[model samples]
Target: MGALHVLSGGAARGLIARLREDFHQHTGRTIEARFGAVGLMRDRLLAGEACDVLILTQALIEELVVAGRVLPDSARALGLVRTGVAVKTGAPVPCLETPGAFKDALLAARAIYFADPAKTRAGTHLMQVFQRLGLMPELAPKLRFFNNGSAALQALSEAQEAEAQGVLVCTHMTEILATPGLQCAGVLPKSFELATIYTAAITARSEQPQAARALIEMLAAPEAVADRRADGFE
Candidate 1:
């Protein structure tokens, strides 16, 4: 069992702990994982960062493959995860059934927060949601972007202190809501829900190619899927 360095997207946030345990148990390897937004991780890899494996959206992984960063035929789909929405614990749940209702919820929100779109696909889609609902101009002034989950959670926590409402992020990081102080608001209705599929691949220059492949297989095993769903992905 050797050290396997991994560069991955934020979508895998909820299931990391389980994945680490399973991979270590299976191959006796310790995965050194670096999770960031897909775009940022892709930039770092393109800039020559060394990593044994890469786990990210299939679209991004295929882009890397096309650019000759990842080996052809190495990309393997893990599963799909849909973006989600939640409110901090104790907050009143809002009606998000229709597009108009969702827009109203946004306009009524005091301070809306989400990950930086340039760095995250979820945030990018959320931006599109705003545009589709024709609420961009009105909501733009109040929108706040975070670097990562911790930043978003911090904003959600602090909003209550100032007696202002905060719009929690909708992404695979939905597990963060179970962290004691946050509550479950509701996910976007089916009409607006976006599902993102994840894929894992060995980098073209990976030193631990075999180990990387083994880890990817372990992550896509049956048990891993259950763990993933428990973490708020589906």
Candidate 2:
């Protein structure tokens, strides 16, 4: 069988990778995934990138369906991801039990990293959280932006190893939790928490429609969701 191509966001990367092995084992099918920021993935699809499936936030999925870029009926919710704070292993975990504590923890960090707010939904909501906390002006100077959460975490890791400078990253709990040697400080406080529902759909240009639907169904299976929860999905 031809390999099914899937374009996905970073939040779903690990869970999908693990599940694909099981998928191929039992079904003798193959899946190839391209993962990155949701916005970047959407842009690639809009620019005519070819893939059998698209895995990303529900908002992006809706947008693509409206644009006729994905089959509306094929869309299914896979899981929900929450925003959280993370630090390199061995760093002191921050207290996030209260909104004031969350703001204080962020303010006290030596360097804070996240994806570009102008380009990623997670980053944009993070910016809104900062604004709500009245820390934007103070946090802006300490903020470092990257192409995606992975890059931001990479940068944070390097800074920690080389300079011992304390650093924190803000992104989906799933991505942070998946990164080796990174410890999730805590989810964003309830008042400011952001949960993004990730969904999967067959692309408009899918060459393997039946295979794509099968893979999407596999992703929504109870076993898949259990794996997702273990990876920090809500």
Candidate 3:
């Protein structure tokens, strides 16, 4: 059999990668996955990308269902993933117990890494938070934007080796934990927290609907709750 095509948001990359070998073993088919910003993934699907499965924010999945692009009955939510903060491994964890502390930490950092605000949920929310705190002008020069959370965190991890001082990153908790050389400090302070429900569905145009559904079942299986939590899903 040929490969199963999947387009997923960066938030679910860890879980999917963890389960890839098992899925291939069970189904005798490899998975071809594209992980990126949710908005970019949605745009890919809309632009006629060949996809057997689609994993994205719950609201986006529902919108696709109504748009007749995905199977309504095949949708299942993986879990909630929160936007969080991260620091380089072995670096001092910043105090983020309150909104004020969070602001202070950002101001103190030499640089701040994050995803593209125009193409990701976490990035968009973080932008709003910075604007709300009136730090946009002050922090603008320190911002380093990437295409997705995983990339931002990866850059943060690499930056640590080159610089003696540590930097800060804002992305989904999953991305923080999944990336090596990075430590998950914690979720963003309550006032600026963003918890998104990520859901998966078989695409309406899937060539292997059964395989796609099986992959979704594996991802959302109740028995995998602990694994999901370890992977930063709530």
User: In lDDT terms, which candidate is top?
Assistant: 3
Clashes of each: 3, 0, 0
Give me the runs in candidate 2 sitting further than 4 Å from their true place: 158-164
lDDT of 3 by residue, 147-203 (tens): 998998887778745572658899999888789888878888888899999999999
Clashing pairs in 1: 87-185, 88-183, 89-183
Q: Predict model 1's lDDT versus the native.
A: 0.73
lDDT of 3 at 6: 97
CA RMSD per model (angstroms): 2.5, 1.6, 1.1
Per-residue lDDT of model 1, residues 82-192, tens digit only? 665656767777777776777778888876777888767677888888888888889888878888554676567666634535565455544454344666566777778
lDDT scores for all predictions? 0.73, 0.85, 0.91
Give the candidate order by descending TM-score: 3, 2, 1
Clashing pairs in 2: none
Worst 10 residues of 3 by lDDT: 157-166
TM-score of each: 0.86, 0.93, 0.97
Which residue runs of candidate 1 sit more than 4 Å off their true CA positions?
157-166, 173-180
Deviation from native of the Cα of residue 222 in model 2, angstroms: 1.9
**Tens digits of lDDT, candidate 2, 1-234:** 778888999998777767878789866788888888998998888888889999999998999899999999999998788888888888788898898888889889888899998888888988888998889889888888988987887666666464535688998888887788778888888889889899999999999999889888887887666777887777
